[model samples]
Target chain A: MDKKKPKKVFVQGAIPPEKIANSVANHQSKTNIGAHSIFLGQVRADEVDGKTVTAIDYTAYEEMAENVFHEIREAAFAKFDITCAHIYHSLGKVNVGELCLFVFTSSAHRRIAIEATNFFVEEIKAKVPVFGKEIFEDETHQWKVNK
Target chain B: MKVTVKYFGLVAEAADKSEEVIELSEVLTASELKKQCLEGLAITDKDSVQIAVNQNLDDAITIKDGDEVALLPPFAGG
Candidate 1:
């Protein structure tokens, strides 16, 4: 795999479940990978006051976010003995119980793959300039912040 | 000198526009420009906003003509 090339990480809407399966199938030829770790982020229906969140409308500084994602990928590759990694995030509205982020990492051992996946998740939340507007059932909204 | 300022998330909502170009008679630091652009805006926590010059997050950088500046709020990605 071309590990140095930057991959497009943003999808227009919620990440589909079939894409996860496809990702796994695409890696079947890489016999050297003994372990793979995957992480999926789903939107939750959190209640704020009397309103319940129905969906999240995501927006981002696209150019900056893409560059930051690339930097995080480079750092992950340098820090872990991972064979390959893939990351995907949602850009538009994603309904509750839908997937928003998907991270996959493969390595010769289990620990390396797991650690890389966790690292990617943390870095993405803290570094990427992506924003989320939590929309309630009544159409009221509030900005979400990473905690 | 004119700089293109792009707003995102809560900043954009508060500013009521996604992007605008401002003419500056003199050079200003990214932080200064951030304050000037955010002045009188309805955003409650203005300190939470960050500035990026040409896609790099640096408040100390001096703004130049045609530079692309971004006002980013707290990130909520996963």
Candidate 2:
């Protein structure tokens, strides 16, 4: 156990790959990790029932969402013997085929990281307050929220 | 209390905006907003709606002055 408290963040903004890469480097330096699994979610240019998805406008109830995200992260750490985890998601109007989310988890072994990554994505989808609007190429649009 | 109601995803289609302010008293809640939404607009499937107050999922949340509320429909993004 370290003297400093662990950091949990939920940011409703765009994420740069370099920042995440740097954070991962920091985590690896702290732990003798054998495996680091990363999951990236990218928006795709496609259609919803014949309407092509040209762009996605994302929005969030930022304060509440951050609170929920931080709590979930703490729960994950309590359940897994992981070195570190990070989740970054985007906000505002994201064009078709843009990266919106990244989940990186590192642990002492491959098995733990893999399982933890899966759990991370699942919990995020179910719990996080992020929302998106799927914009069709034709100009028609629809809201994108969890079922 | 006057609070703003925001619509997102499918819910936005129904309300047709990111958010709007309505004159409400303390008795007004998130659920009442859904009803008002249906009455003000021709929105269907009121039960399928998801409500957020100040950005978190608030099904039965109460309203306050200057609070912003968001209405969302079934999430379809990954």
> Which candidate leads the pack in TM-score?
1
DockQ of candidate 2, scored on C-alphas against the true complex (2 decimals)? 0.40
Fnat (0 to 1) per candidate: 1.00, 0.41
* Docking model 2 quality class: acceptable
Candidate 2 clashing pairs, residues 3+ apart or interchain: A61-B55, A143-B9, A143-B10, A145-B75, A146-B75
* Per-model TM values vs. the true structure: 0.99, 0.76
Candidate 2 on A1-102: residue-level lDDT in tens? 431254445344445668767877787566588889898877778666877887778776566566766776778788888877777777777776666778
lDDT of 2 at A82: 82
| Tens digit per residue, CA lDDT, model 1, B1-78 | 989999999999999999999899988999999999999999999999999999988899999999999999999996
RMSD of each: 0.7, 3.6
Candidate 2 runs further than 4 Å off: A1-20, A145-147, B1-4, B25-29, B52-69, B76-78
**lDDT agreement with native, every candidate:** 0.96, 0.71
Best by DockQ: 1
What lDDT does model 2 reach? 0.71
- Candidate 2 residue-wise lDDT, B1-78, digit = tens: 788776665566655676677787547777876677666665567787777777656667877788777776655433
lDDT of 1 at B39: 96
